[model samples]
Target: MLIFTSVTWLDLCLASAAVYLVKQLSGKKNPAPYPPGPPGWPLVGNIADIPHNKAWLTLAKWGKKYGDILHVKVPGRHIIVLNSVKAAMELLDKKSSIYSDRPVFAMGGELVGWKDGLAFLSYGDRFRYYRKNIHRVIGSRTAVNVYEPSEEIEVRRFLKRVFAQPEQLDAHIRHTAGAIILRISYGYEVKDNNDPFVDLVGRAMHQFSQANDPSAFMVNIMPWLANVPEWFPGAGFKSLAREWRQTLKETVDAPYKFAKDQIGAGIAPMSYISNLLKGRTLSAEEDHMVKWSALSLYAGGADTTVSTIYSIFLAMTLYPDVQKKAQAEIDAVVGTDRLPSFADRDSLPYIEALVKESLRWNVVAPTGIVHCVSEDDIYDGYYIPKGSMIMPNIWSMLNDPQTYANPSQFNPERFLDNDGRGPEREPRTISFGFGRRICPGMSTHRSIHLADASIWISAVMSLAVFDISKIVENGVEQTPEVDFSSGLVRRTLSHPEPFKCSIKPRSAKAIELIQQDVNY
Candidate 1:
């Protein structure tokens, strides 16, 4: 091959520039009709307008100004926000295949080494592989029941901790959730709050949430900045990413290695990891996937479960009437002689409604793992381009006045019909997400998962065992505030601010029942 002259190199550069200009210019010609949104400024588009905190609320307000489905453009990218159930169903659910992909989460995924996670994976055969494995392992009806005893054991342990040290309820919940997830995913037991595994995983998760926050990393917006040296000015995020990567790697590998060691020693408990490892001889890549997926299960389940459980407790404290009503229903069915179990779910209609309402009242995953479009599509005369981010405003949908009357008020009766048989319209608190990207592991100790009812059993049992009320201080009752955090996952924003709650035994029989259940 002959070396190119300066003139030749210049000509080549001109040709490339010409093609790029043409491509950019062509896109502007006959541009598809994008959905109505707040008018954005030149160059930056809506990037400046996007609210870092409480984005869902701002999007909902935008929905009222601009129709139910609205669009906002950041430089070189597009975002579609769906604020109504009808609109979300029409696109995210009805046309799922084309709208089920995930956006490129540069900061949260690649930089932090979370790309192996199923939640952040793009739509493809690999995504399908992870999804298939997850569903096979935990999403199936049979698989869910297989893990019920582990869930039940962890939950009873949590109840005992709450009964013993209710002041440390938060730590107890965090410990219980971590322990249950570790046991189910890797056959690993979390010994205490200071367990190395819990600490490592917890740090990774905390960093993950921070990295995912829109304002946390600038490299997410300008990806090229990631290539810059870590020591460069304004490149501190890269250093942070490096630290996160180390923690995350340990989070993904440590428990998996422990499980493998147990299996090799012939003392491994049956678990998602142990079973999968024993079933087949996977390639190196497949093995990596399994490890990451197992870690994801632990990471995904723990904090979300904590949030929902906290919300349940907050709701009970705030609305004693609802608590009394659910307790009455539980007592009527299960009797005060024993703690309510999954067997009583069929009879406790009010408790079921209470569960649904808690999910709907203050959703956990508000925007719910934003979906991306795989191809260009048009809905109601508006164009949604391929690769556009789709945010289903679950918070808005949950609080829709049309679907839920007095939605802000904590009311379980909304789930019941006039006859009070079952749910009139199931709460679309799809906090787990939607379409194929939906969270396969949705079960928690206080909420029902798609396939598992063990956690639901725990929630009812807690309700049956304790009467949560405002703490009586000197002669006055101080009610805990129903304040919530504004993050990707909604949580009781209290920063260990000792919320006053009098967690009293419903009766002597109830305490006896709790002891009996705890012993089992």
Candidate 2:
């Protein structure tokens, strides 16, 4: 080692002083304090502390240590997680103009071409145009009414599949949800369970979810890695993205092209696409928006419904009394000769309670697609910088003991008041989401037509037709361990697991009604 003189030592001290001054100056713009959070390391911040599994629960735990509005930084990014319904609504709803934008999802949005989707689009003129057009087709409750015949036919098919192969309940649910969305979006019939469109679309979404996992790829944090050549060493993510991009292209293009061809040939069915095509001539840009917006409908619809219905199955297995109560209510209103329809929903109060409870108990999207702050602002006396990711901890809000007494228990009675007629509380307020960014399909408005979500309709139909009970092996009934997936969206993680349950037709009349399928 070389010896340093007083002159060299003085130079080093001056350099260190200059760096400190620069750091202080950089923080002056947003000198307001960040929301309370766990201690973080220098430079890396709380990167390692970011939970990889069930992050929504982890964030809630952090919220207790920090405050309701917890702040954490990951490298150059800022993340604000709202742990309570109050905070979520204040920021995501009351201040939606600034909080409705989405963060840049490099893997899911950019590389896979999902940025074109309305769900992932940035806040701008294009976003508004896409949203407006999507609403025109699927915005109203009356619009859903137009599809009730098809929905009923599909539900009947679902009932038949369940009756035949109850062991494949998950597959049947997925198929029904997929078929309904496919038919509604493009008038495409899902040919059996192995339709190529279903498979391809499933693969594309699987890849998107994989990429969506915060830890799945580093390129999400360091977007520059997306630019690396496919052949570059350790650049396999690029190839993965390309493969998924191709699948996504085919998923959006195949059905859309067919819909266009049918429309041109004058044999078009009354689908969302056909309805859109019949009206006014669309410019190239408008056409592009419609194509991708329709795809967003498919992306948003099926998986959440399938996950919740699976939760309902699990709930029925665990809570037999709840199942019995719902069945009793359904039987009293709908009778055994006919299956339940949308009209029967209001009449069966217990079934409605069960549906609401299913959503609140095991939320499909624990932390909904995170919103981004479009400008710097202060919330609860803490500074939230522009472009910060705002995560609404839906799980915490739904599970909070203060909100729902005995929150861990799966009790539908929480929603029923003394009369057991009108609801004391509404879970949909927390389940679908908050503010302007709320799920379009789940929102309610009396001014518009009575549009209902497919999930809600499917849940009522399933409960109406089948009697769910625990699976017995070797003379012992087994309770399924509630092992849900830790993905951004919750689902049963693994297949061929021990979550066995049996579903049977409640009566011969029910089976007969299901078999007598009506043509749409």
Candidate 3:
């Protein structure tokens, strides 16, 4: 179908201009070399070379041929792919002062108005303020520990949900994460089912992923396309962006109003926003900071944890031996009488390693949030121009054979120092991010680590009670494929596509434990 039949003329003109522009840029003289990458087209640069799915694989393949850092140009954009943790850390980390800024995303940031959120906020006063707000709440292990009770309570509820309907494992995880984040972020408790706020988050986040996908919308690569009026021929993306922008607005506004309203009634539970709002009068700017920062907590923790935790179940289903080993450790250390808790975290080394393995294995946010350089500098004899987009190829870093032996295998023991060989490098160091822009996100140090305790609690509690195995149809066991998909950031921790598994209580005792009262 020629969906853009009326706008083919417009697209052709844009392509011609793009071709001439790239030709001009490539014809320039450079003081030093750019990192080697696949040769792009004569006209459109590397636009055709970019894949719409599993992009990390293509980038990693380029690394094998072009070295760790590969530069590619597409239309008006210049991209540098860092396929090794060393290269990422050297540039994105050691050179943090000039590397922490975020790209101005055309579709998500400009069109849908998500740039105000911490994830896409530029490096400036508001970025620092947002980070300060986030860190004050969950900056440290001690601060995050404050939410342990809430996390354990939600994971227990998750166990009950999975027990009741294993087929809806995906929905159960999403609800549980939303419940935990909303409670902490707004002090608002979500209903057991069909919670409006959770539903809103689900819808809003889906739009978020679709909006940021460069390949999904032409406006992302060509920002001017966003200027096309809704009534213009083949302007469907513009229409979609408008609708998505409203959803993003509600995602930002609705929860914020709820938290403020609850505070007004003098019946607000303590939460991230309430902690900031309880007795303080704020300037409109401060209020904006608190509101969006609170949503940042919701946006970051809620979605990604779903992906990380879901992968744990998928890991258990496909690798029964690893699951049994970890479960045995749980039984040995925590016992069957009660589910595991944060207090037992240090005592269960295997479970801890299992959590680390899961983080590495799943590779959430595989290609991390793009980092925009603030100035130009030379590194390793390469001319890294200012405004060149840097993508930390996190998927390659975690799975690099040089970093981990048999990187493709799901073995928790790789994280355990055994037989005189030290354990492989911890995945968290690479997974969360690199340098000033690294996800310690709200503050300088935490990034995805905000959810570390949450992931552990969920994993420990679920493992303590559930036995996950391959589902059998017609008496034949079906193995769940280990597939993790990525879009832009919000889709960072999405569900495994076509996930299938059977989750059940290990025994009547396990059932009783999952059935415990889940009030904190």
Best by TM-score: 3
Report lDDT per candidate: 0.74, 0.76, 0.82
Q: For model 3, name the residue pairs that clash.
A: 131-442, 439-447, 440-445, 440-446, 440-447, 441-447
lDDT of candidate model 2 versus the reference: 0.76
Please identify model 1 stretches exceeding 4 Å from their true place. 1-26, 419-422, 442-455, 487-498, 516-520
Identify the runs in model 2 with alpha carbons over 4 angstroms from their true place. Answer: 1-29, 419-424, 444-452, 487-498
Which has the higher lDDT value, candidate number 2 or candidate number 3?
3
Q: Please state every model's RMSD to the true fold in angstroms.
A: 6.7, 6.5, 2.5
How well is each residue in 1-520 modelled by candidate 2, as lDDT tens digits?
Answer: 1121232434433554565567677856665889999887655568788666667777889998888998887755789989988899889889999999987668878888888887778988988876676666777766767777778788778888888898988889889888888888888878875798889888878877776655466667556667877776656777778888998999889889988998888888778789888756989987888788778888887677777777888888899899888878877887777778877766877776777788788777888888999999998789999999998888889888877888778898888875645554577887777776777654354222212346556667777778889888999988888866653232212212237898888777777876785566
On the 0 to 100 scale, the lDDT of residue 315 in model 1 is: 84
**How much is the lDDT of residue 198 in candidate 2?**
88
- Candidate 1 — what's its lDDT? 0.74
lDDT over C-alpha atoms for residue 355 of model 1: 75
Superposed Cα deviation of residue 287, candidate 2 (Å): 1.0
Instruction: Estimate candidate 3's RMSD in Å.
Output: 2.5
- Which has the higher TM-score value, candidate number 1 or candidate number 2? 2
lDDT of 1 by residue, 333-411 (tens): 8888766665567788888788788777767777777888998898998888888999888888888887777888989
Q: lDDT at 185 for candidate 2?
A: 88
